[model samples]
Target: MDRGTVGSAQSGRLLVEVREEGSSAVVTPAGELDHHTADVLREPLEDCLEKGYARLVVDCSRLEFCDSTGLNVLLGARLKAEAAGGGVHLAGMQPVVARVFEITGAEAVFTVHETLDAALAD
Candidate 1:
């Protein structure tokens, strides 16, 4: 497993953990994600996509905050996965994070689930 810390402002913190599971790559993000941390997500995510993983799951249950930058990274990841004949799913989004997606009209764009288990089941 590899971990990268992103945001560290007084607002919150963000850490992204990357791990492999069979043919898929899982990115577990813990903490707040804003403009400062969005790029941190893009790097690893694009790396996994380029590695030919068939599925990408971003676990956000532990995420306490997010901004448009974070959302852009997610949408970008989804696009990358689709371009590679793969899929991107979001799991375990906290209420605030979920609300960001909804307010931005991204809830309809992402296959978001309440838990990692549910996302994996799909």
Candidate 2:
């Protein structure tokens, strides 16, 4: 149940918090997830994988905005997780962010949940 922050105040536009939940690593990213801030999310995700956590849950309840770069990061993580016999699950997406996934057909590729509890339950 260790929790840590991955983003820095000086260079990071996004704030990512990492926590362990069961066998999964939960990454909560807040603020804008654009090209400039994608690394904030990426670093924690990679760390989770390196630590042998293949099941990832991205709690997007506080995520205010997301761009194509953000989507790309998630997709790449999904690929890596799946290759490791685990997967990336998304939960609590905002309308705008959800629309981005829907428009890009990424919704079909990801397992979306209505809440963090739901994601964890699955």
Among all candidates shown, the one with the greatest TM-score: 2
Could you tell me which 10 consecutive residues in candidate 1 have the lowest summed lDDT? 3-12
Lowest lDDT sum, 10 consecutive residues, model 2, at 2-11
Writing each residue's lDDT as its tens digit, candidate 2 over 1-122 gives 44444333223568888888878889988888999998888888888898898999999998999999999999999999999999999999999999999999999999999999999999
Candidate 2 lDDT:
0.89
Which lDDT value does model 1 have at 112? 81
Query: Candidate 2: where is the Cα deviation over 4 Å?
Result: 1-12
Q: For candidate 2, give the lDDT of residue 108.
A: 98
Model 1 clash number = 1
Instruction: For candidate 1, give the lDDT of residue 77.
Output: 88
Once superposed on the true structure, which residue ranges of model 1 sit more than 4 Å away at CA? 1-12
Per-residue CA lDDT of candidate 1, range 1-122, in tens? 33333222232367777777556677887877889877667777887877787589888887888899988898988987888888888999888888898888999987888898787667
Task: Highest lDDT: give the candidate number.
Answer: 2
